[model samples]
Target: MKSFKHTIRALACAFTIAAVSTTAHAAELRLGSGFGDNHSSTRAMRDVFAAKVEELTAGRHTVSVFANSELGQAPEMVNQAQSGINFGVFVSSAFFNSQVPEIGVTNMPFIFSDRETAFKVFDGPFGEKMKPLFEAKGLVVLGFMELGFRNITNSVRPITQPEDLQGLKIRLQNNPVHIATFNLLGASPTSIDASEMFAALSQGVVDAQENPYAVINSFRLYDAKQKYVTDTGHFFDVIVFAVSKTALDAMTEEDREAVIEAGRLATLEQRSYAAADEATNLETVLSKGVELTRLTPEQREAFRTATAPVLDEVKSRLGAELVDEFLSAVDAAK
Candidate 1:
């Protein structure tokens, strides 16, 4: 009788251990993005990061992606992540600027002359310098993706020169630096969320907006009756892959390392995908019947000349030292 009782107790202990182990092995993370499912950023997370994480963790951990702002707008998703709401986000530098104003330095007009130069700067020390800003705000900076160079689109008219942009009501991102920059260029700029952009354009709430060629194509802004597209290449924005620090801290050490590695790989792959897709996206926009304008060197320089003073205006807000470091990095990359 004594032996039977001991055997029963051991069996119960083993069952409990098995249950606990099974529970520990099943962990899931939610990654959210404002981009559509087909967007490269979303695809990278779904195809690269998700696969890599699953492989590294031996199926013990997985990622569920919410694309097309299914989770929420950038700001809301960012808040959810910070509050430990089982979320991660690929936030745009413009929106993330709300949390870390220093990031606005990257949004300065004409800072990067081309994609290669921009990539070199971001993948170098300057990019690493911005990580702690996110960490301090209770977010983990996983990696950076490309938002590509911003171009101008309008229902009003082609913007080939600084004078052409005059009197247009432009929809600017909810970034003060962007607002100020457009305002300086003589356009009336209004802050609007990306989710509401199509309606804003369709209803004539704003006559103009700016984004990368890929974004314009992905969002189908041509459907909003935007008649003209200008390759302004004004700013090279970054999409930051970030997760809640609280959520990261709760992960096991091995799982945490796996997550980090997945992010690094995904970022690298996504950047390449975005760069290669730019020309194709430009073609798509043209096929949609929008007039596409490629500004000459002189025409682009006119824009540069007009917005140059914005650097001085925004320096105090973004920290002079930080801006100097960014410019120095750009110079070095060149």
Candidate 2:
């Protein structure tokens, strides 16, 4: 315990040294996210997170937000937070695997059938277990926001079954678990940063990509000619709302409470918005002349079967006991 507190204090010193405040007000906490300005996550950051922080702190502290990866790509922004240049970030849990592999427990293919079970498992002991892993690496887990279930999109043709994915180049987040799932289904998966995805699709750098409807619509991928979508819902992704332990410790106790409260409120609001907006986003995409394919239970089962080995793969990487514990937690929740 003494060593842990020492670690926290050392981190706070590093952050304080990086950004020295001169005026009566301390440097505004910079919060960054990879989502675009129009995305719900970005909106939550602006209206709920930033606003609530100021409200709770009575204007003594403030939060400044940069949307659309304005701070940098996922890895770059993550490094900045660790270095104490930023206070908090909203980034995909997949990106943090390089730092904390246990995060992949949530990335297993077809693991979640619906939002209720997903939230039950994540908001319970599984979430508590994951937080300390992050703290050990200099990040404080503020909360987890829904990125929602990911779907597949391409210019070629509608994918009605798992066989249709064979040999096509698909763009996926830089997650090994996702890559393994797609590989088993016989697709060539490439890792592309979200910011560069539009160009890659327009130039035919990759033939298809998978993301939630929010991403396809908000990022305007249809404009890049990705007009066909299959609602694969392969993985239920989460956005980790985390603060750098360095920056977190630099704040006054009251200020820290404000940040935590803001994160909690924003997370709840964001989840509600995310759940309700998927239909609206799908409507917007259909209005753009994008072809949508909704899979049947049997068809989705084919996918579930093909990607089943991904569980074993993840267990190999993260450990069988831990992975089984996560699975058992999901079962208990169900």
Tens digits of per-residue lDDT, candidate 1, 289-320, equal 99989999999899999999989977888778
What is the Å distance of residue 193 in model 2 from its true position?
Answer: 0.2
Which ranges of candidate 1 are over 4 A from the true structure?
A: 1-26
Give RMSD (Å) of candidate 1 vs. truth. 3.2
Error of 2 at 69 (Å): 1.4
**Residue-pair clashes per candidate:** 0, 0
Error of 1 at 320 (Å): 1.5
Model 1 scores worst on lDDT over the 10 consecutive residues at 20-29
lDDT of 2 by residue, 1-334 (tens): 9999999999999888765554233558788878988788888888898899989988877889898889999888877777777877888999888888899889998988898899898799988999999999899988889899999999888999888999998998899999999999999999999989999999999989999999999989898889799999999999998889987787789888888889999999999989999999989988899999999999999999989989889888889999999999989889
TM-scores for candidates 1 onward, in order: 0.92, 0.92
What is candidate 1's TM-score against the reference?
Answer: 0.92
